[model samples]
Target chain A: MTTDTYQAVQASNINKRSTRWAEFLIQSGLGLCALVSIITTIAIIIILGKEGFSFFQHVSPAEFFLGTRWVPLLEPQSFGVLPLVWGTLLVTFGAAVIAIPIGLASAIYLSEYASDRVRSIVKPILELLAGIPTVVYGFFALTFITPLLKGIFPDIQVFNALSGAIVVGIMVLPMIATLSDNALSAVPQTLRQGAYALGATSYEVTTQVVVPAGLSGVMASFLLAISRAIGETMAVTLAAGATPNISLTFFESIQTMTAYIVQISLGDAPAGGIAYQTLFVVAGLLFVITLILNVLSQKILMRYQEVYD
Target chain B: MSTPNKPAFQLDYGDLKRRHRKAKIFANFCATITWMGVALLAVLLAQVSIDGFKWLDWQFISSFPSRFPAKAGIASALVGTLWLISLIAIISIPIGVATALYLEEFNSKNRLNRLIELNISNLAGVPSIVYGIIGLAVFVRQLGLERSLLSGALTMSLLILPIIIIASREAIKTVPMSIRHAAFALGATRWQTTWAHVLPAASPGILTGVILALSRAIGETAPLIMIGGLTYVAFFPEGPMDSFTALPIQIFNWVARPQQEFHELAAGAIIVLLAVLLLMNAAAIVIRHKAEKKFK
Candidate 1:
C-alpha cells in the first residue's frame, strides 16, 4: 500500500510539472503569433519610409507636393502629387455624395422600421454586395455603368471618374449602412420609448432621438467610407482613365494615386530606380491618409460609444 | 375663467397630424431607398449573368487563357487561385487562431495587451494595397521570395490575419466561462482545458470567420497586382515558387483590353468568382447558424 501511494504521488507531481511546462510553451507561442501584426506595421513603415525618403532626396518635397505634373518617364519628370490627390478627392466626394443619403436612410430603415424577417434577408444581401470582389465591380463599372452614363450624357468619356465614383459608392454603401445600423441599434431602447411616450411619432423618435444619439457613429462611418474610397484601387484603375490630367470635370478621365501605383508596377521600372521608388512614395502618402482617417474614426467611435448595463 | 392661460406654444392637433403623415411618408421613402440599393445589386448580378452565361461552360473552366477570348479559359487562374488560397489558409489560420487565443484567454488587461489590441484594429483598417507594398518589400524583394505564388499567398495571409483574429476572438468570447471553471475544477491544465474543450466549441465560429476571410482574399486584386501577379499565364502554376495569376487579375486584364470578346470573357470569369463566393458565404451562414444552435 505504501509503495502504491508513493507511485501515485510521483505520477501526479510529474503530471503537474509537465502541465506547467506545456502551459508556458503554448502561451509564449500564442504571444508570438499576436506579435506578427505589430511586426507588419513596423515593416510597412520601414519599407515605405526607406524608399519614400530616398525619392525625396532625388526630388524635393516641395516639387513633389506642389508640382502640377507627374510624368516620371518623360525627360523633364515632374512628380507633383496634386493631380492624383485631386482625382482621389473627386472620387471620394462623389462617392460620399451618392452613398451618404441612401446609406443613412437604409440604416434608419433597417434599424428602426424593418421587421426582423426583412432585416435578416436584407442584411445578408447587403453583405453579399459587400463581399463581391472589387475587380468585379470594376468590370461592372466599365461595362455597365460607364455605358449607361454615356447613354445619358453622350459627351461623357468612356473612362471617367463618375463611373468609378458610382461603383465605389455602391461598394461602400454597405459599410455605411452596417456601421450606422449598429450605431442606431446601440441607442438605448429606453430613449426611443421615452420619446414615444412623449407623443412623438415613430419617425420623430428615430430621427430626433436615435439619429442624434448615434450621430458620432454615423459620422465615423462616413469618414471610414471616405477613407476606403480614397484607397480603393482596382475599380478605379479599370474605370478611371490613366491620365494624370488636372481637371475638375467628373466626366473627364483622371488617374488616382492607387491607379498611378498600379501603372508603375505594371511597367518595367527597374528595381531601386526613381520610377520604382516613386511607387513607395505614393504608397507612403496613401498610408498616411488612410491611417489618419482610421485614427480619427476610432476616436469618434470611442468618444460616443454608449455603455449600458 | 376657470382654465389657466395657455402656454405660448401649445400643441396643435392638426399640425401634429400633418407632421405625422409627413414623417410616415419620409419613413416609407427611406425604406424604398433601402430596397433601391438591393435592386441595384440585383441588376448588377443580372447584367453579369446575361453577358457571361454563354461563355461559362466546362470548356471555359478547363482550357488555358489564350489571346483569342473564344479560346481562353480560366483553368490557370482558377488553379493558381486555389493554390494561393490553400497556402494562405495554411499560413494564416494557425497564427490567427493563436493570436486570438492569446488575446482572449492568456493576456491580462495590461498595457501590452491593450497595445496589441490597438495594433490589430489598426491593421484591420489598413488598406489592402499597403499590405501589398509590405509584401513587395518584405517577402518579394527583401526575402527574395520573388513574385511567386508563395509571396502572394503570404501577403494575402497578412492582409486577412487581423480579420480572422477579430472573428476568432469573438468566437472565443462566446464560449461560456463555466466550461473553463469546470475543467479547472477537474484539475485539467489551462492549455489542456482550452485545447480540448474551448477550441472545439469555438471551432465552428472560427471556421465561419476563416471562410469569410478567404472569400475576401480570393476577390482581392490590388494587393496581388502590387505583388506582381501576372495578368496572363498560359500554364497552371506547378508549385508555390511559380508565377501565377488570380481570377481577379485575369479579369482586370481582360476588362482593360479593347476587345469585346475579352470583355465577355471577363464577365464569364466574374460569374465563376461570384458563384464561389456565394457558395462559401452560404456555407459560413449555415455553420454559424448551427454553432449558435449548439451553444444555445
Candidate 2:
C-alpha cells in the first residue's frame, strides 16, 4: 500500500475511536440520570426501613399497626397507627365522594355533549384549578369551606375533617375530570353508534355503552385520585386540625398519617428521638400503600388496554 | 298508499325533524351543565386573578412581610422559587433524559429492564406528599440538610422524576427507529447513533416534558411544607443551607391570616405564581409545536 493511503487509514482509525468514546459519554450521561432516580428510591426505602426497624424493635409492630390509640408525644407513648389511618381513610373517602359524581358528570358533558367551543375554553380552566397549590386549597378549606360547613352544622369544629375533605375533593376533581374525559374520548365511535342504532336514548348510550367500555380507565383514574387524596398533607395539616381522633363524622377534626408526619417533623423532636422515628415508620407505611395503589392502577390500565394507541 | 292518510305537517320530514329538535333541546340543556362546570372553573381563575392581582403592587413585589399585609413583597419568595426550580431542572433533566435514552435505545426488553420500566411508571403515580415524607425522613432528618432549599429541591426532584422520565421516554420513542438502524448500518456504535442521531431528533420532545414537570414542581407546596420551608423568610436565602420560602408558601401564609387585607396579599402572590406557571407552560407548548412541525 502507498504511504499516503496508510496514513489516511491510521487517521480514520483514530477518528472512529474518538467517535466511539464520545458516544459512550453521551449514553452514560443519559443512563446515569435514570440510575440516580432509582438509587434515590432505594435510598429512601433503606433509610426509612432502618429507622422503622429500630422503632419497631423498641415498640412492637403489632402495637404500631393495630393499636387503637395514637399518642406518640406522651410519656411511655402509644404508637398506634389506627387513628391516623382512620382519619386518612375518612378524608380520602369524603374527597372521593365529592370528586366522583361532579367530575364524572362534567366529563360526560364535555366528551358527549359539549360543543367544541365550550371544550376549548373549559379544559384549560379545570387544569389551572389542578395546578393551583395545595396550600391554597388549605387556605380555601380553612377560611371558606369550614365557615360554610359551620353555618349548616353549627356544632362542627372550626377546623374539621369535612373542610379538608371538601377542599381535597375540589383539588382532585380536575384530575378525575381530565382522566375520565380522556377515557370517555377513547371509547370507540362504533360502540356509541351501535347503541344509538338500537334506538337507545343518548343517556342510555352514555350510561350503558361509553361508561362500561371506559370502566378500567375510569377506575384507574379514581385509584390515582384516591392515592393523591390519601397522601395529601399540607391541606390536612392546616385545615383538618392536629388531633388524632378516630371518627367517621366529617364534622370532627382528625389527623391523617401524613399530617402526623408533618406535625412531628414541624415540632422540635430531637434529631434521633423516637418521635422523629415515628415519622419515618409512618412514612414507610404511607409509601407502601401509595406504591401499591399506583402499581395496581398501572396494572388495571395495562389489562384493559383502554389507553388508545 | 297502504298506510292510512296522515296530516300535512306530519307528511313533511322537516316538521317531524323540528319536533324531535325541540326534544333535543332538553339534551342541549344537559349540555349546558357541562359548560356550567366549565363556568365554575372559570370562576376559580377569575377569583384568583382578580383577588391575586389586587395585591400586586411594587411593595408587594419588592419588600418582605410586616404586621400589615400591605407591607409584604414577594422578593425572597420569588428568588427562592427561581433558585429551587433552576436547581431542580439542572439536577433532574440530565438524569431523566439519560434514563429515557437508555430505556428507549440501549436496553433490550429483558425482564430486568422491563421491571425498571414498570417501576418508573409506578413511581410516577406515587403521590407528591409521599415524596415529601420521603424527603423529610431521608434528606432533611437523615442527611442533616434541615429545611434548606437543597433538600426541598431534591424532594421536588424525586416528586417529579417519574413524570420527567415518562415524558422523555415518549419523546425518545417518537424518534423513528429507522434513524437508529440507519446510523448503525453506517458503522455507528450504539452510543454514536443515540448521541448524534437520536438525541438531537428527540431534544424538543424531551425539553417540552422537562418544562411541564418543572412547571408542576414550581407550583407544589405540600412536599415543601413538610420538608421545613418557613412561611416567613424576611431575608433571601444566601446559601443552600439557609431556610427559604417559596411563592406558594408565601401565598398560603397570607391567605391563612384572619385579616382581610392578607387575602389581597394572597391574591397578589397567586398572580405572580400563576404568571410564572403559565409562562413555563406556554413555552413548553410552543417548543412542542415546533417539534411537531420539524418531525412531521
Whole-model lDDT per candidate: 0.90, 0.80
Chain A agreement with the truth for model 2, given as TM-score: 0.93
Model 1 C-alpha lDDT per residue in residues A232-294, reported as the tens digit of each score? 999999998898888879999999999988888888477889999988999899999999999
What DockQ, between 0 and 1, does each candidate earn?
0.54, 0.33
Cα misplacement distance, residue A40 of candidate 1 (Å):
0.3
Q: For every candidate, how close is chain A to the native chain A in TM-score?
A: 0.94, 0.93
> Stretches of candidate 2 above 4 Å error?
A1-15, A306-309, B1-33, B49-52, B141-146
Judging by DockQ against the true structure, name the best candidate. 1
Cα-lDDT of candidate 2: 0.80
Interface DockQ of candidate 1? 0.54
Residue lDDT tens for model 1, B1-296: 11567531223346887878978998899899999999999999998988899999999999999997779999988998899999999999999999999999887989989999998998888888888888888889889999999999999999999999999999999999999997666666677778989999899999999999999999999999988657778887999999999888889989999888899999999999999899999999999999889878
Instruction: Judge candidate 2 at residue A200 and give its lDDT.
Output: 58
